[model samples]
Target chain A: MHTEAGPKRPTTPVQKGLQAIPLIINVISANFQLNQFSSLTLLEFALDSSVLLLVGGNRGRCVWATPMNNIIAYLFKSSLGKKYIMAVTGCCLFLFVIGHMVGNLQVFLGPEAINRYGHFLQSNPELIWPARIGLLVFVGLHFWSAMQITLENRAARPVAYANSKPVAASYASRTMVMGGLIVVSFIIYHLLHFTFQCKAINLTGQDFVGFTDPNNHHDIFKMIVVGFNQPLVAGFYLLSMGLLCLHLSHGLSSMFQSLGWKNDAYRPIIDCGAKVVATVIFIGYSSIPVAILVFKFGKEALK
Target chain B: MNLTLKVWRQKNGQTEGHFETYPARDIIEDMSFLEMLDVVNEGLISSGKDPIAFDSDCREGICGMCSLVINGIPHGGHAGTATCQLHMRRFKDGETITIEPWRAKAFPIIKDVATNRSAFDRIIQAGGFVSVNTGGTPDGNALPISKEVSDRAMDAAACIGCGACVAACKNASAMLFVAAKVSHLNLLPQGEPEKHRRALAMVTQMDKEGFGSCTVTGSCEAVCPKEIKLTFIAKLNRDFGVAALLGK
Candidate 1:
């Protein structure tokens, strides 16, 4: 009965949990690997299994569900579905960006204070990693869902148009993937430079040497100042934040539509508000490095 | 009246479309909007360039073939007015009028402003028709539908598949068009047999066509060009809900 019950889903928490485990494994394994087997090995396994399933489908075996038939309704039918997913993720991401910007704004509190804050964050590993994991999963899901919709859009129109003008899609809409990739890259490069110990990135200090950020608070703040004091690092940070701002401009309003929250009455007002908010928040963060650059080295600013 | 027209031109779907500024100097105020476009096309042809192609027929505003988005408003910004009935008098002399076809994911640009509105036809054909026998030469008013029901049906039947609702909606939702058909038929006793099937089939087809969902934005009604109320969508939602609950 137990063995038979395993196959008999649609009931029982145990069976549901069993069914759910593979999903969790698949989701985590699909992401950027931290250690152990490389992504390529997993890719080969996934490809081989999917192909086997495809070939096996020709026989009288059952497949879980028709992928197209199940999701096509939401992806194809309603603009609200698109807006809903975009909205939920956008709002969440916005909250995170705002929080991040606030944290980074500590740079203006003077080097010692900023360094102490960074130390506090570093010391609280138990708190930080879990938040990071949640953030990573959400970001992954948001991007995956977006990619699915964009692909569906392309499928509706197969013939390539060389001269066909795209509709009034916002800059954020068109640049979602590009901005996302840039941010992802920035995150990795940033972590390696400040958090992770890759030799190329850890030029200023030994990675993790300030261990829980700098107790005297001097070294931690000095490290951050020195990091931004470099014109090259400052430029990259500013550019990434610019992209994040552009993404938010479209993402906020678009997400509202996805979640079925927007109407003609509220859409325009919210869209404009999003644009203004995105610009302000992004510029607020970008201003830090610019401030550092100006106050510290504006006399030789361009130099 | 002198009219300067800025029209979107593209040779084909594969070609790039651009807004070309043209002058419609010495035009009569009484001519229908199509007639003004004809004058512009004539000017373009006289120069050996290709004439602009647009949809129109039954120029009296009944056929619903005239699809035009003028000055960022569908059907020249008039409520309950078809593009063909829109006259040159609506514009000032020397007005730089901009014209383009309805832009929506569901409606592809076939040529210039002419789109493949066959999508709407497919939706209707999916389940809009009633199952009736040929030999039943039924007497007039044999079904004895209530006056309110008949009037409502007539209102729904008035939809000419013009794609105006799509043009009017910000998300380009086709709910008004779909609702009109569903409501008109479902309101009558004759259509009761397939009410559930009709609603489901039409909605499925609509989604299949990539038309956006209805948020009851009321933009469709505001710029309907026919003043088709959004009650049809309400009727559709009710039908679908009942049908799904009944496990039909």
Candidate 2:
């Protein structure tokens, strides 16, 4: 299957060994030589030949050990491959969001519970930092791949349509970039307001109310109460949540489709599931601010 | 009726193109879109000017050769109808119709309104066919197929490679085209043996040709001359996943 029509000059021991395993060589070298040689020839050659030599066995047995690594590598070099990357990273971020929401829900359980939870997270610096680093990687990859694909898609159609009309795509799907930008900005604001306690909000300063729990913890419960009490801050959070909902409404289902998990039988379920999850997350997160502002449940916690 | 036409004119793939206006006089409501173009071309030739260049074959929708994005919609944006099948009655008299070629990186304009769609042929060559042996014809009922299955297969088989899906797509994705080809063959019993291989090969070729990824916009189905459904893209995705995981 090696299409090199020249003489079969096997120079290296690896080439000779590969020649002996004709069946395995044919299957591996045929498709691999055609497509993958351009980018991954050296890597695949060194890896596969070394593995074959290490296993030194009957040719028939060795033939079963053709390397599929190059095929995957080659597949990922294309636009579709980039999309698969985005889907995977997006799923990771989705999981992170769900986990964060679950943790935040402990705030409704009162000061001790939420403070203990916050203390548990902060106390494990090694685990928490590594998880944070991993999440940052996912976010970076998700954003980078998204930007790359969007630019490529835009370049594909340079000339704008004079009277364009969308038939199949939803408003949410079309506005993903806008919503994503809003969510990213909100995340920065969120980290500053709560996690870092940046000077912008000046939480510990005289201008803002500051409270610590009995254990002298950062009093995350009181901090959340004071944070949401500000109408502007609460309004920004509510608006960002709405945008996040819009982003996830399309993104969740699209992630499945991008990863090739969609089929006619389960398409409706996946689409509806995306909408439901987005709405539920929106309502769930929005409830905290609504309860703080309207019902004033956390007023005493702030004091 | 008289109609004003703003036709895009380009020398070739390399040079820039611009819109050139022309008046099509005494255009009857009965004339097909291509026939109206032909009349306008005849007038241009009689007046010692170069005629407009476009691609058309069979003058019916089946050929898939007639390609024009009229007023920003591929194949006149009429569902289930090609540019050749579009009649002049659809447009109002004295209205200016804007005609442009299929604008996608994969499809370069060879001239005015005619693009090189060989990228599509390359995708087909990648593995759009079954590996059946040549022999005497099998019995009519040799392969048992349910009516629903056959109809669905036929529905996918109706894709004419018109590139309207690409033209209409926001991303210029040919997912509908590739999906139709993959689904039509894979749905049949005769194509069962090479199902996984076909899916992998065709999708790989599609990406290699520089077509953008499908975001499931549904515009391709909306503008397809065959009205090919978007579900075929979903099937293609399914087959691609299975093939990538398990196929040789």
- Candidate number of the best TM-score: 2
Q: Write the per-residue lDDT of candidate 1 for residues A93-193, one digit (tens) a residue.
A: 78988998888777667656677777678789998999888788777767766665556545444433222222334457667767978977887888776
**Per-model TM-score versus the true fold:** 0.58, 0.84
What does candidate 2's lDDT look like per residue over A72-101, in tens digits? 543445566667777888899999889999
Candidate 2 clash pair list? none
Tens-digit lDDT track for model 2 on B137-205? 988998899999999999999999999999988898999999999989999998888998888788778
Q: Model 1: clashing residue pairs? A: A83-A257, A83-A258, A83-A259, A84-A258, A84-A259, A86-A255, A87-A255, A163-B15, A163-B16
Best by DockQ: 2
DockQ of each candidate relative to the true complex: 0.12, 0.50
Summing lDDT over every window of 10 consecutive residues in candidate 2 chain B, give the lowest-scoring window. Answer: B239-248
For candidate 1, write residues B157-204 as lDDT tens digits: 888889977876655678789888887888888788899778767877
Please state the CAPRI-style docking class of candidate 2. medium
Q: Which stretches of candidate 2 lie over 4 Å from their true place?
A: A1-71, A124-134, A201-211, A293-297
